[model samples]
Target: MGRGVSGATVVMSRNKFIIYIGILGLLIAAGYGVWSTLEVGGELVLSGVVEADDIHVGSKIGGRVLKVAAKEGQGVKAGDILVLLEPYELNASLAESRASLKQAEAKLAELVAGYRKEEIDQAKADWLAGKVQHENAERFRRRMGDLIERELISHQDYDDAKAKAEEAEQRMKSAKERHDLLLAGTRHEEVSQARASVEMARARVEILKTQLDETVIRAPVDAVVEVLDLEPGDLVGAGKPVATLLRTNDLWVRAYLPEKRLGYVQPGLKVKIRVDSFPQKNFSGTVRRVNRQAEFTPRNVQTTEERVLQVFQTEVVIEDPDRLLRPGMNADVFIPKTSS
Candidate 1:
């Protein structure tokens, strides 16, 4: 009797366990059905691809590539150095500019300060010497004239004496002019010209400095380097893109909506996004804009002939707080139909 009772109790316990498992399975199935409905039932889904603005980074002033700091598919922050150009030429130019600026500034300073005392003194000395030479030459020429009149000196000797006197007078005049100019000091026009030259030289130096800074290619926004085909020895031209970066911080979606849907869609409309990679997750976004004009579908539509007709381009700005989304990912946008 006791053995039978124990066997009965065991059988009863197994039955209860099976019943509990069946009830749990039914509950799970019911919950999954509800979830599927919630995921699939509501909203008009529009398909698009994740897109971000591609930033082309290059040097404003070109040179041979000196260093490539980042590579393809590498994430980078704003202001990060992506590449460096050979600064030897720019550095040399900057040095030359500095020298030129210094020379011009020195000239300006000299003009502003006027002739030094030592220079004036030397001019005075030169004038005195020239005067003495001129007086002596004049005396000799007069003597030679008297000799020639008496037929004591040859015609050639009198001519030579006259030439020497005239040369001495010209030299004396030049020296006197120099002395007077020193005493007169720098003229306002001369100082103005020197100052202008200094300003021009300084401006050139600043321009070269800015060009030197351009040799370093920096990221303007947080991005991923999508293309970097340059190495250390590669020569790149000015204003030519060396690397292509996909801006990750500011991402949006580009979708094509049928012309008929234009009435229901407008900017600032709330939308949900779903990517194939994360089907269970939904991202928030807002309609940024809708194209005014319509264009034919880019490619043959797989769904229906109607979808292949004219469509308006739409931009949706995705809100990716955790930065979980990336460019080129195919996405489904769920835009709520507003009562038109």
Candidate 2:
């Protein structure tokens, strides 16, 4: 009877101990659930960095830097000069082109207007003189021929007279042709050639002018100068970046959302933004875009098996009317949570 009572007591103790362990495990699981809800269940907020479009401003035509018109961190508007290069050669070339264009235009005008009245008169006079000389030579040649036929002149003398007559006749014909050409003025072909030359000169001048303008490097957009270390006499090549600018008109936050939470946000929806610089303040931002391609990247996870997760990149444009935000700032973006 004593042994049975002891055995029953031991069995009851073992059962009570098992019940206590079961109750402790339930309590621990409940605590963990409550903690997870407090930590990340309320909102889908994530961290992001502020970024802006960086523009590299430079000249298409390279040259020795004459002057640095703007410095780093300087705010500039469109068309503001950021640097100036030596344009001495370009200016000289432009002037020379302009003079050539003027000369070509003058020639074209002259050709279109024909020859002067004085020139025409001079040509006509020459033609008439040639005709008189030719007639005199012809009369002499006839006399020489008649003398040779009658054996009154030597063969050499007759030949000389004949040659003079032929030369005189040729001179008269050339003179008459010159006079006729002067009367006809310039041909259409000549006028067209002259006009073409003028156009070519003008085109060269325009190209030079454009290069001269490029020597003065100007801001293409309204931005703040981020990098401008150049000074006078710094030689740079064409299309080399001389200055870096950060556009202040639009700032964006680059964020990565997990593929599982992709449906939580879409474009055109507003979200809350906060930065460490102004933790108390809240900034408004709109979703700009979401990348369609998912990438495998490591996320903050405790277990090694859950280290990598698929995520999509998202761009959110921040709206700051007061212009307080800048690039490279750490911002906390609160993504709205949705069960669906």
User: What is residue 242's positional error in candidate 1, in angstroms?
Assistant: 0.9
Looking at model 1, residue 336 earns an lDDT score of 67
Candidate 2: lDDT of 289? 95
Give the worst 10-residue stretch by lDDT in candidate 1.
30-39
How well does candidate 1 match the true structure, expressed as C-alpha RMSD? 12.0
TM-score of 1: 0.67
lDDT of 1 by residue, 133-212 (tens): 99999999999999999999899999999999999999999999999999899999999999999999999999998998
Worst 10 residues of 2 by lDDT: 30-39
State each candidate's clash count.
Answer: 0, 0
Report lDDT (Cα) of residue 308, candidate 2. Answer: 29
Clashes of 1: 0
